[model samples]
Target: MTAVKVIKVVGTSEESWEAAAKEAVERASQSVEGVHGVEIDHWTAEIEDDEIVEYRATTEIAFPVQD
Candidate 1:
């Protein structure tokens, strides 16, 4: 039997949402192990002076529970 857990993480990038998501996963992986998958949950952006300043991505990361 195996158990999995889900965690929500938010990452930001001036480049793209994909980069933001990847950043979140990479940052999480630094301290976490056994990562199974990452699911993009939602996306939002910050606007400054009617222009997009930054992109933010919210992701759900699934990983195996460590014993």
Candidate 2:
């Protein structure tokens, strides 16, 4: 039998939410092996002075469990 794990990660980008989500997955992949997929759990942004400052994304990254 095989086991899978899901972890939540948050990443930020000034460009867009997509970039932020991608960043989170990429960063998580660095330490996590056998990455299967990513699911966008939630998303939010930060604004300052009526201007978008940063885009933040929350994602659930799925990967095979390490033994």
Candidate 3:
């Protein structure tokens, strides 16, 4: 049997929520191995004068642990 682990990470972007989510996974992959999937748990944004200035994403990264 294989063991898996999950970690929560948050990422921010000036562009869009999609970009923020992608960044969260990518950044986690840089420090973590066996990254298999990412689940977007939540989304938030900063508003500036009726415009969205920033986007943030809460993600859960799933990876396998080595034996």
lDDT of 1 at 48: 97
Candidate 2 pairs with clashing backbones: none
lDDT of 2 by residue, 1-67 (tens): 9899999999899999999999999999899999889999998999999998999999999999889
In the range 32-53, model 3's lDDT, one tens digit per residue, is: 9999999999999999999999
TM-score of each: 0.94, 0.94, 0.93
Better of 1 and 2 by lDDT: 2
Clashing residue pair totals per candidate (backbone < 3 A):
0, 0, 0
Tens-digit per-residue lDDT, 1-67, candidate 1? 9899999999899998888998899988887898879999999999999988899999999989989
Better of 1 and 3 by TM-score: 1
Model 3, residue 20: C-alpha shift (Å): 0.4
Global local distance difference test of model 2: 0.94
Candidate with maximal lDDT: 3
All models, RMSD in angstroms: 0.7, 0.8, 0.8
Sequence-dependent TM-score of model 2: 0.94
